[model samples]
Target: MLYFDHSASTPIHPAVLKLMQDTELNHFGNPSSAHQFGQKSRLVIEIARKQMAQAIGCLSSEIIFTGGGTEANNLVLWNLLHQQKKHVITSAIEHPSVLNVLKQLKEFGVTFTIIPVDHACRVNPEDIQNAITKNTGLISIMFANNEVGTVQPIERIGKIAEQHGIPFHSDAVQILGKIPINISDQKITMVSFSAHKFYGPKGVGVLYLKKGTNPKSLVIGGGQERNLRAGTENTSCIAGLGLASELANKNIAKRKTHLEQLADQFKLEMTDAYPEIIYNGHPEHSLPGVISATFPAVTSNILIIKLDLQGIAVSSGSACSSGSVNTSHVLRAMNMSNDHNIRTLRISFGRDNSKEDVHLLTEKISEILKQHHNKR
Candidate 1:
């Protein structure tokens, strides 16, 4: 199958898979144990921590490994809520992990200010600044949107948060491998990552907390992850995440150029073939390899199925909310028309995809639309 769902998850790189398998087979000791085997495992985890930290330009001590991106986001939101921060600030287009957690926090008398995005699904830093109040203790915004691939003005938002003395957090899961991210330069207080988004094994993620930023632990019972995250580390997955991060950091420039070419080619070909196609996200400031488009007179669900039948994989929305009956919250927040929302499809590329792959995708999609029209 020609996979075009990199935003949902990426196939593990061969090197990363090999490292994970080797570690799992030979290193089975609990990281908390004091025995030689445990120490070896612990060392591996720390090394991985350093690797992740280096990738994002943060201190090794600042990296807290979590089960996945959802948990990392939960940890940050939960901690802020626990601190009795009565007000929080976030964008309307955050991942469900952040938006849903904020929804649950309303039970504790926490008020939220959701800044809406523009028609291109780009957040306004000025709006974020104006939303801050004395009770607003934290601001959570995504670095780049998952579905539409719109990159936020994170540096400007970070500066606003700094001026207001509120902690700033970004869900950087999609940005980690596709673009270069240095937490130091962005002035972001905390960031979340998922390994599977960047060709690493699933089940491992990282939360980068800058120095002097403290969040209460979400899990209890163990002293792992500096007591910020509990339970013995998933050693193999952590190792894989480290190797993946290193590879991503080393080759980001090349990968960005390649993916950009493929995404542009796909858009040019598809739009030329189908004039009714409407592109989503910011025209110039979007992610390199991800694109969303609306196909007129077609429901995305049916179109996705047709594409899948033709051996091309794409997504109607976020993988986390695939089966849900509701429309995309991201699209809804962007003020997309109901008809266009139903017709939206998110197509993401990766290192494995090439110009030829994009050509095939465009051809198949054109055929599918024609078939769909003929039947209608």
Candidate 2:
């Protein structure tokens, strides 16, 4: 199948896959054990952590391993409960991980302000500034939206958070490999990443907590991840993540250019075929490979199945809420109509995609639209 869902998860790179397999087969000892095998496993995890830190320009000691992006996001947001000020400032277009955690925090008497985004799904930095209160202890914003692929003004937001002495956290799951990240330059206090989103193995993620920012430990067991996160590490997956980080750091520019070419080719062909087609997300400040296209008369659910039968893999929105009947909260927050929301399809390109893949996708979409019109 032609996979166009890179935002959900990327296919593991061959090199990363090989490393993971080798590590899993040869180094199966628990990292907590004091034996030679355990020490080797420990080394593997540290190397991965260091690679991730280097990729984002942070200290190796600042990284914490977690189950995935959700856990990573939770680790930061949930820690607000232990703070003297329990209020957070975030955008309305955050992933379910952030939104859901914030929602649940409400029950614990921790209030939050969800600043609204504009029609382009871009959060206004001024709105976030206005929403911040004296009690606002944290500002959690996503680096790039998962559904619409709109890159937020995180650097500005980080500055605002800094001015107010609030910790800034970004759900950077979609931005890691696609964008060049400099944690210190951005002034972000914390950022989260899932290895699978960057062509590494699944079930592994990283939370980059800036030095001098201490959130309460989310998991308390043995002394792992500097007592911030506990439990045995997934050594093989961590190795894969390290390799993926190294690859990303080396090829960020190359990958960005390629994906932009693909996205440009796609839009040119798609707009030529359907002039009324609507593209969501910021046209200027957006992820290169991700596209959110809305077809006015088409039902995305039906189109998704039809495309699937033709071996074209796409998604209606976030993979987590794929089959749900409810429309996307991201689109809704941007004031997208219910009709347009239902008609929207998220087509995300990855390193594996090519010009040929774009041609096939647009051709199939045209063919399907023609069939639907003819039937009607």
Question: Residue-wise lDDT of candidate 1 within 1-376, one digit each (tens)?
Answer: 8999999999999999999899998888998999999998988898999999999998999999999899999999888666756789998998999898888988988789999999999998999888888889889999999999999998899899988888998999998778898787887898999999989989899999888877788878888888898788899999999999988888789999999999889989998989879999999889998989999778999888888887889998799986799999999999997888999999999998978899988998888889888988
Tens-place lDDT per residue, model 2, 1-376, is 8999999899999999999999999889999999999999999999998999899899998898888899999999989889899989888888888998889989999999889999989989999888988898899999999998999998888888889888999999998778898887988989999999999989999999888877778888878888887788889999999999889877789989999999999989989989899999998999989999998578888889999998989998899775677999999998998999999999999998989999999999988888888888
How many angstroms is residue 315 displaced in model 2 relative to the true structure, after the best TM-score fit? 0.5
Q: lDDT of each prediction vs. the true structure?
A: 0.90, 0.90
